[model samples]
Target: MATPEFVLSLREKIGHDPLPLVGVTAIVFRDEKVLIGRRADNGRWQPVSGIVDPGEEPADAVVRECREEAGVTVRATRLALVQQVPRITYANGDQVDYLDLVFRCDWVSGEPHPADGELTEVGFYGLGELTDVAHEHVRKIALAVAEDDPASFVGGR
Candidate 1:
């Protein structure tokens, strides 16, 4: 997993302090299937996701992450969910709190494969038959699956 250059630069100044960042998840779909990948770092199955580069559109980040991590071409159809992820402390001692933007994407072309080393395996699975997936990711997939549904805002008022 390549750390974005901007993050590395920030780390130099912040050290291990908690940093707020924006991230995006691409819940790519094809018919009845959803794209999933086994992350190389944690071996957890998840939707293709990555940090939003500075000044990059969140939707564009979704497309880029899917291609770079899963070897698939996808069109981000809609924003599915917005939520604040719990703070995560990396093995390197960096802490981050991410504002996650989840997008529902339609597969345009290409078969799923681990194009980059971030994932060990990549493939599509039936939405109802998913296994080895974290509960949070499963929730994201569920919220994104219905095309007519409005995007979910996890917290409110």
Candidate 2:
């Protein structure tokens, strides 16, 4: 998707100054594997995630993101984890800090594929097979498979 309208308008006023944003990631599991994707914007091999639109519930945003980015329908089963991202400078020069909401979701329908410009590839992966990703992602995947309750991982990283 294009840069969010709110964000674009905000940038027009404040330039690239870092802003705190909320986002959601999906840990969509099926059979014995979890869904992951390579971001079209950054080539990051990670879980499907997106910035939450203004006034959107985090879980709803995650489900919408899963479909938009990965072409899969998912039912979020639980809030999985919450992670605080340090400031990041996007390649486009927009800077932001993200409060991340990670959700554990069950596969609902459709095969994983790059459904939009936000993703270049999408597939299910076994935990042992995930690599070259941020350690927190790996940790969240492992946690999702092994736990039932939501986890709060306040981080400084």
Candidate 3:
């Protein structure tokens, strides 16, 4: 996994200190199937996600992450969720509490491909048939698919 250069630099100065960060994840749907990518580092399938870069909008970040990670273009249909995750420590010794924004996205174009080094596989799956996804992620997808309102938020309080 290639850690961002800026993040790596910050870790050098403040080793493992929990930095509060923001990120976005896209639940991209095409033909009623949601897209999931197998992470290269963990080999587990999850939605396309990434940290919201400095000065970037969360919606824009999700679109960019989807294109880079899965070689697919998407448009945000709604801001689906906002969750402030407690501190999470990565195997690489980096720590952060992420305010992750989940976006319901509509697929615009392109097929699934591992365009970036982050993912090894990218494919679509039905909501009831997902495997290898984290427990919270399963709920996230289900809520995104079932909910009609744009302001719906799913997170542990």
Candidate 4:
């Protein structure tokens, strides 16, 4: 399968007025290690995430992003958190305020690899050894996973 066109188009469309974008991310853990990817854009570690296509449910987007970014099939088990930031400024000078739906999921199949070119590295990190997480919200998701509170959205600092 090819990389979704929506991902490419959305990058150009960011910063447009009335930009209404929804995205999904996942916190996938096994044996006390959390799956994370080093973003090629920012070089910081973060969970699998991508923009939600039009008409796609956030849960579905989560699973799709997990597969696209990590090359792993996952089943979303629960709604972990909803991160709605009014404005997010990107390194490319494209600002996007998004409604981000985060989910807790279990890896169903496929070896973890950087399927999408956006990720530079991918691996499972122990809770105590995570370092330089890319975004505050990503860190929050990791903390929530460590606490075993799928609903928690607190930072790991």
C-alpha TM-score for every candidate: 0.98, 0.91, 0.91, 0.79
Candidate 2 C-alpha RMSD relative to the actual structure: 2.1
Q: Rate the local accuracy (lDDT) of all candidates.
A: 0.94, 0.86, 0.85, 0.74
Clashes of 3: 0
- Per-residue CA lDDT of model 4 for 90-152, tens digit only, reads 555556677777788877888789897878889778866665775675555654474356565
lDDT tens per residue, model 1, 69-153: 9999999999999999999999889999999999999999999999999999999999777878999999999999899799999
| Number of the predicted model whose TM-score against the real structure is largest | 1
For 73-139, candidate 2 gives per-residue lDDT tens digits of: 9998888788788789988788999998888999999999898888888899887788777887887
lDDT of 3 by residue, 24-117 (tens): 8899999889999899988888999899888888899999999999999999888877888778888767789999899889899999899888
Best by lDDT: 1
RMSD of each candidate?
0.8, 2.1, 1.9, 4.4
Candidate 1 local accuracy as lDDT? 0.94
| Least accurate 10 contiguous residues by lDDT in model 2 | 147-156
- Looking at model 4, how many pairs of residues clash? 0
